[model samples]
Target: MLRTIAMGVLVGSAILLTLIVFRKKLGWAWLSLFGTHLILAALGIYIVNFSGLLTEIYIPLNPATIGAVTVLGLPGVIMLLGLKITLF
Candidate 1:
């Protein structure tokens, strides 16, 4: 139940953020926002990787990973971490 709630929150946030990005910006502005988002997501991944030393949970910096983090922000990276822990 808790995990379900968290997942729902993540999805809602992603949708809200995505809508804001599309609604308030256009053309190159949104592109810059996307680039910024990608950078932040990459940083989040690195932080996770760094923490992984103790937790044994690391997310690889690949296109799929990047895309998920880029699109979904922190929640997406978190979901990846959860997926890793649950599956691997």
Candidate 2:
């Protein structure tokens, strides 16, 4: 709960800073970062409430397996998304 929100905030801030640093040249990157953060935040909530979404199949991948994994994996996904959007 608290951990996920804190981490999301921190990760979001970092992404925001990166976007600011590359404001003019990386508009696409910024948008992707924003999307990735959104995903992370969603995943965080999903994880924290796993018992509730156990049967949801609307999304292909259920990112919220457990708290620790969700907390750690979100940043990885975000980084991958960022890299994919920025590099290729």
> In terms of lDDT, which candidate is strongest?
1
lDDT of 1 by residue, 2-87 (tens): 99999999999999988887787754676788889989999999998886564777789999999999989989988998899999
lDDT of model 1 at position 44:
92
Cα error, candidate 1, residue 25 (Å): 11
Provide TM-scores for the models: 0.65, 0.31
Query: Which 10 consecutive positions of candidate 2 have the poorest summed lDDT?
Result: 57-66
Worst 10 residues of 1 by lDDT: 21-30
Assess candidate 2 and give its TM-score to the true structure: 0.31
Candidate 2's residue-wise lDDT over 1-88, tens digit each? Answer: 9999999999999999888778757557766766676576667545534646334322224444333234456664444444445665
